[model samples]
Target chain A: AQSVTQLDSQVPVFEEAPVELRCNYSSSVSVYLFWYVQYPNQGLQLLLKYLSGSTLVESINGFEAEFNKSQTSFHLRKPSVHISDTAEYFCAVTISGGYNKLIFGAGTRLAVHP
Target chain B: GAGVSQSPSNKVTEKGKDVELRCDPISGHTALYWYRQSLGQGLEFLIYFQGNSAPDKSGLPSDRFSAERTGGSVSTLTIQRTQQEDSAVYLCASSLLAANPLTNEQFFGPGTRLTVL
Candidate 1:
């Protein structure tokens, strides 16, 4: 079985400040990792993913996450955040195969204050 | 082009009542997924459908939950004997039919918020 953990339930930060959302996973087999964001009253939107290749992955919206194998972590980070960046972030995983369902973390709520 | 759409954006039901949610996936997409998000919680996978094939109902919480996809287009989720614990937003997502499936991105719908009193 595979599971994901997002330790921080809520994070508060000032605008233009850097922030990191921590994620850890426990899996018996290799899995694919993903981060998704959900704005207020909105559906989930994929932020970034680590399928394979480089440990570091980036999204177009200035969010990045690095896959750390030894630590079993995939943490999301942004050097600077805007108020608009405040949202609910989720970390998910799926078995390394075709069209499988994703197991998700409890989610982290990022609140950016102006 | 239209994205995924769901019906009855909000549903209110009594404890013993039943509720049915619908999802219309993106055109020509061959993969569909169902998930549940409880209040202030993350998503829980419920089921998945690929084409007309049988759906993967492994994540369903109980026998009270069932889903069906027809004509490889639309899908419906039915909850029998709903309880307060069943109250949550039901999400539907769809992806393209690819050989590897990893290359496809799953697009989501607004979700149906089911509230059981």
Candidate 2:
């Protein structure tokens, strides 16, 4: 079984500021990591994912996340955030073998202030 | 036709009533999934269906929650005798064949917000 933990429940940042959302997971075997974002009253959208190869993966919208095996962490980062970036973010993990199911974190609410 | 579509964007039901939520996955997506999101909480897996494989219902909170996918396309999640705790947004998602080694991106639906009173 795999589980994901997001340390921050709420993250507030000013426009154009850098922000990082921390996520950690525990699993016996290798797992896949993913980040999804949800805007107000909207469904979640895939931001980025770390399946294999490079430990660092990036999204087209200036969001990136690094997968750390040693630390068991996959933290999401953005160099500069815009007011429109305000939304709820989730970190999820799925085991490679066995049943394919995603274990999600509690989620982090990012409020970008203008 | 563009993305995963869900019916009844919002459902309001009374306690002890039964409610059903529907989902239409994207064409060609063989893997369908159901999840629930409580207020201020993360998504809880309910069931997963992949190409004639046995559906995985491990994450279902209780027997009150049940789901079924038909013809490898649409899926329905039902909550019998719904309780206050069942008041949450029911979401459905789908992806290509899980066995395929390519990037697995599960496209999500708008989700049905069920409010129990």
Candidate 3:
């Protein structure tokens, strides 16, 4: 079975500060990694995904994540965050060619302070 | 285009009662999925439906929880004899295809928050 672990339950950062949300997964076979962001009282939206090719995937919102095959990690990073960036971020994984059911982590609450 | 939508944004039911949560996936989406988000379980997949194929019920927690997708567009997740443990937000997502990751990006609904009293 595949599983995902989000190392931080909560991440606090000041506005314009860098932030990194750690995520690790345990899967025997190849997998697809994704980051979903949920703003206050809103549904989750796809932030970015690492399917193939580039190990470093980026979202249009200036957030990026590097898929480290050796470490089995896909950590999300942002050079500088804004107050609007405060949200709950989730890390998810699914088998490369298997069913589309996603295995999600516990989620990390990103509290960007002004 | 409109995204996935879920009905009864919030549901309050008593224990031992039954409840039904509805999900309306994006039109033309071939794949739909149900997931539960709770304090204890976080987020867990409950069921999956793809086109006309057999629905996957492997992720269901127990027999009390059942779901069905009709016409490949709308889905209903029925929880019979609900318990306090069943109190959580039920989320629904849909994608164009279930096979290819390049094009299969799941779009989620606002979710139905269920509270068992």
Chain A accuracy as TM-score for every candidate: 0.98, 0.97, 0.98
lDDT of 3 by residue, A14-43 (tens): 999999999999999999999999999999
Could you give me the TM-score of model 3 versus the true structure? 0.98
lDDT string, candidate 1, B1-117, tens digits: 999999999999999998899999999999899999997656898988988665477889999999999999999999999999999999999888633546667889999999999
The residue ranges of model 3 lying beyond 4 angstroms of the native Cα positions read: none
Docking class of 2: medium
| Between candidates 1 and 3, the TM-score winner | 3
Worst-scoring 10-residue span by lDDT in model 2 chain A: A94-103
Question: Which lDDT tens digits does candidate 2 get at residues B1-117?
Answer: 689999999999999999989999999899988888997666998888886454688878899988888888888888999998888888998988765436467899999999999
* Reference-based lDDT, residue A54, model 2: 96
Best by TM-score: 3
All DockQ scores: 0.60, 0.67, 0.88
lDDT of candidate 3 at residue B111, scale 0 to 100: 100
How does model 2 fare in lDDT?
0.89
Query: What lDDT would each prediction earn against the true structure?
Result: 0.91, 0.89, 0.94
Number of clashing residue pairs, candidate 3 = 0
